[model samples]
Target: MMRIVVTGANGFIGRKLVRALLDQPSLSGADGAPVPLSDLRLFDVVPPEVPAGAADGPVTVRCMAGDLSDPAALGAVMNGGVDVVFHLAAVVSAQAEEDFGLGMRVNFDATRALLDACRQSAPDGAARLVFTSSVAVFGGDLPEVVRDDTAPVPQSSYGVQKAMGELLVQDYARRGFVDGRTVRLPTIVVRPGPPNKAASTFASSIIREPLNGEDAVCPVPAETGLFVSSPRRIVANLIQAATLPAARFGRDRTVMLPGLSVTVAEMIKALRAEAGDGAVARIRFQDDPRVRAIVASWPARFETARATALGFQADASFAEVIRAFVEDEMGAPHKDPVS
Candidate 1:
């Protein structure tokens, strides 16, 4: 039997990840062997809504809500020992940029605190910790196509924080405090909620808002390219990052996940193809330099040979990304989203 912990459990990715884990029979242990999941603890700033059947189900589920910076809160989640820790909590891009202190508190300091907790008491061995990072970590004189080993020169506070977190994860794994793996993610598209403070929120809004039969704004030029993945691929890759044998990582613990390299124009084209010109007609372009400058700093293409070799995957095209949102969220063909 194993105990699992997922921080940021209230967020969309975190919630979906929890659901996916519930569907699983077991998870890979430190020994690289599958073990039955005995308990799952969801930790977040707010109480995460417990999915149906999880409470009385075979696997025990516990929901915890509190400030991650609070030792008492961290202690509650850290107690009883943990076999795997999926650390997904972070102050997103624009929000972080807007408040440096909050970003440092959540993304960096809290992350270090959690690692210390795992080091102090893990499941008789190091815990398998999967850290979700962002491509925003790459900036300034980036190669036309970023490689697995591209040096990160972040241009934003959020990027700097994530880059720092990645370093800590690598160091922790190196010190034998934890078996940590960092998966640097591309901008996720068609996120299922209303816009947050992320500068890249417009990426999802352009498609999601229109598909939901609403007007949307595009704050960046159509020519702006982005390296992106779907929520489905990210979840699968997160699980993959956790289960893969620790021996496979060797010295380097960071991986740039595979993603589609596409332009905003191409994305709109795909949206139009899927939902028709009506959807395209709904988007109004009015550039906001703040949002544009922040997003433009991120590298838009990568050669994820390492991630691919490690069994990770990416969406085939932007069209597939749209289809996934429609299938998973809308639950039916849009036929006429504009009605």
Candidate 2:
């Protein structure tokens, strides 16, 4: 029986990950699939809504709501016997840039404290730590195609903090304190729920707006290209990271995930194909230079051969991604083409 602790259990990716874990059948060992969630601990700022029949099973799911920035709170959670720690908590890009101090505290300082706590909790090496990094780590003066060997040139405070966290996780892993894997996720699109304050919030909004019969504004031009992965793909990669053999990852502690590299226009075209042209017409292009500049600085494409070789996969096209959102989150096929 493996004990798993997941932070940010209420956020977009976190919630979906937990649901998938809970629904998973019996897990395997080293030569097989991952071990099942016999004892699972979920921590977040807010309590997550567990599945209806979650409590009726053999797996014991415990929920803890607390501020990770507080040492005392983090200590209490880490004190529990934990085998796997999924560190997903962080301030998003736009919000982090807005409040530099808060970003530093929540993104960097708190993360360091958590890693230290993991070290202290399992002095004999008993846990696997998985950190959710972002593509924001790459910025300014990028080539046409970014590879795993690309030097990190973070442009925002959030990117800097996330990059720092990645270093810390790798260092801790190297010390044999915990088996750590850092995954650099692209902009996760078609995220469920209302829009967040992230600079990348528009990524989700562009899909969510039309689904709800509302119009959305594109801050960047139609030709603007970026890397995006659906929420399902993000969850799948996270699970793979947790289960992948450390020997397979080698010395490269960080991995860039696979995603669809498409322009805003292409994304709209896919949406229309799945939904309809009316939904596409609902999208209004209103350029905001500030947002455009921030997005433009990000890498438009990546060679995720490392992740693919490790058996991680992403959607083939933007339409497949949209259909995933519709099937998994929307609960039904699009009634209106715009929807």
In terms of lDDT, the poorest run of 10 residues in model 1 is 330-339
TM-score of model number 2: 0.92
On lDDT, the candidate that comes out on top is 1
Q: Cα lDDT for residue 290, model 2?
A: 89
Q: Count the backbone clashes (under 3 Å) in each candidate.
A: 0, 2
CA lDDT of every candidate: 0.89, 0.83
The digit string of per-residue lDDT tens for model 1 on 2-95 reads 8999999988899888988998858887677789899999999989878888887789899999988789999999888898899999888778
Worst 10 residues of 2 by lDDT: 25-34
RMSD values for the candidates in order, in angstroms, are: 3.4, 3.2
Model 1 clash tally, residue pairs: 0
Put down candidate 2 lDDT per residue, 64-170, tens digits, no spaces: 88889898889767766777788999988877999999999989998888888878887875567889889989888889999989999998899999999999888
Every model's TM-score? 0.93, 0.92
